[model samples]
Target: MQLDPALPALNQTVLISGPGPFVLLGVPGLVALHAWLSVPVFLLYMAALAGNALLLGRAAADKALRAPMYQLLGLLVATDLVLATSTVPKALAVLWSLSGEISFEACLAQLFVAHVAFIAESSALLAMAVDHYVAILPASALQGTPDRYSVVGIVAVAAVTHGACVMATPVALLQRLPYCGQQALPHTYCEHMGVARLACGDMRPNIWYGLATTLLSPVLT
Candidate 1:
């Protein structure tokens, strides 16, 4: 079948590919992620899955952590658990050379959770940074601030960070995405940025934000 003339111009780039295997973070090239790497990845993933599940369950059951920090931690852990579940099997399959065909819906779900966790992790780190800053201001600054004010700031930062990422991810995921081929992730984990790069449209903003958020996380702290 004849392809669109412009199709030939498409390179394996975010802008060119528009959304899947070719878009966003554009699957980290063809470099094998350690030959036969499945066993250890499976073990590690299982351990994390178990641990996060317990932590999430306990957090949900606890009444005391209704406080902001614990609340943030609980929610973040829950998201992380979801992310872990979404990614580990895929990675394991790729390593083991098993079934690698992921459906569009499943890919989207993994993409959403994993990317959400990426942002959440950054925001949590930022909150921690803010807390540290507030807790250790110069003595002169401390004099004016109330004794309990630092804790309030910490809570506020945590809540803000948590809410921001939760809100941001869905907008990016559900909104306007360029179509590509059937979804089959190259890596064991579902990478949103990687998938986005496969879109046949402008992806500069996504790339820029990904870089900006990652770079800013440490500095903000």
Candidate 2:
């Protein structure tokens, strides 16, 4: 494919074979504001990281917090850390230095990690709610309370199976489509739909699957 001369010099490179690097146009029309935006965003990232880290450390140190509920909290904290780490640094890079070039593989990996962390986080929250409900039930009504290890194991497995495995389908489908023309993605991160929209061929499968997953995610959770 020939590169479009009308395109900006930055975007003249054609993706002839593989899925090439994408230029992330962070928060479109906010180039001037990126410097201002980065301050609060940086602070928020720091706060989230510090708060979660403190909770994780306290849970590890305190024997009383070794309960199943605290175990779920630990899982939540860890998921949050992964979620933040996956996207925030890249965003900061975009805002601070306009460094938004991301290789195809890296983009897919980012989306995968972000989605897995999200699903895992949701599962942990749901498990915590169930744990609380079970706690309030009469002893006679309960068959057997699940221990902390069991709860953790269940959450981990669900995350790996549902989050990691199920999420791979979209990545694989997206990978099959050819990406050509403009490579500028108008977002801070490589979202499923955002990336799919850039493909050259028919994207019905990608669209329908993404919608199906979005709708079914809550029900599955």
Candidate 3:
């Protein structure tokens, strides 16, 4: 079969190649009603943002909230903020503009922020568990538990651990794989598995690493 002269060559690199813009279709089997669905989604985002902001402000302003447990709550609030912001605004844009296209760099940034925030939240919950233990137990065994240093250390470790496992390695692997297939992401956010699935090459490493880091966070914490 002869190809049309006006059409670009099959092997031609037309710039919209690997790691190209991706479409974030919000929710499964709900794309046809994106406009109507966006209303509630936007409202929920506002409520969550307001609630977390208030919690963070109260924790920062009140002297009583200077305790380690409250500080941990503040950490959780920050993580929630990141998690919500990483997707909600872009999702709103996708709904309103009717265009879900996102640049490769922006998608990568969103993917990193969302995963880190989620993992951090899980780690924060684990830290809160330890704090609860210390609070309930007699003070004689551990007189100065749930101190500022310990909270800071836990947050730092979670950030580093998830950053290395999720953000650094898997993303690097995904980047190396050629994304010559479909670019439309099924969910409302740029996630590791969603993006990795679009790659044309071996995706086992990405999948395994994503599962490992996701499962290991709670286990280790």
Number of the candidate with higher TM-score, 2 or 3: 2
Tens digit of per-residue lDDT, candidate 2, span 51-147:
9999999999999999888988888899999999999999999988758999999999999999989988888888888888888988788767666
Which 10 residues in a row give candidate 2 its minimum summed lDDT?
9-18
TM-score-based ranking, best first? Answer: 2, 3, 1
Lowest-sum lDDT 10-residue window in model 3: 9-18
Q: What is the lDDT of candidate 3?
A: 0.78
TM-score, candidate 2, is: 0.90
For residues 19-58, what per-residue lDDT tens digits would candidate 1 score against the true structure?
3332111135633544446557778888888888787777
- Candidate 2 has an lDDT of 0.86
Candidate 2 ranges with C-alpha deviation above 4 Å? 1-15, 144-148
Model 3 lDDT at residue 192: 80
Error of 2 at 37 (Å): 0.9
Alpha-carbon runs more than 4 Å astray in model 3: 1-16, 143-150, 153-157, 160-164
Please give the CA lDDT of all the candidate structures: 0.58, 0.86, 0.78
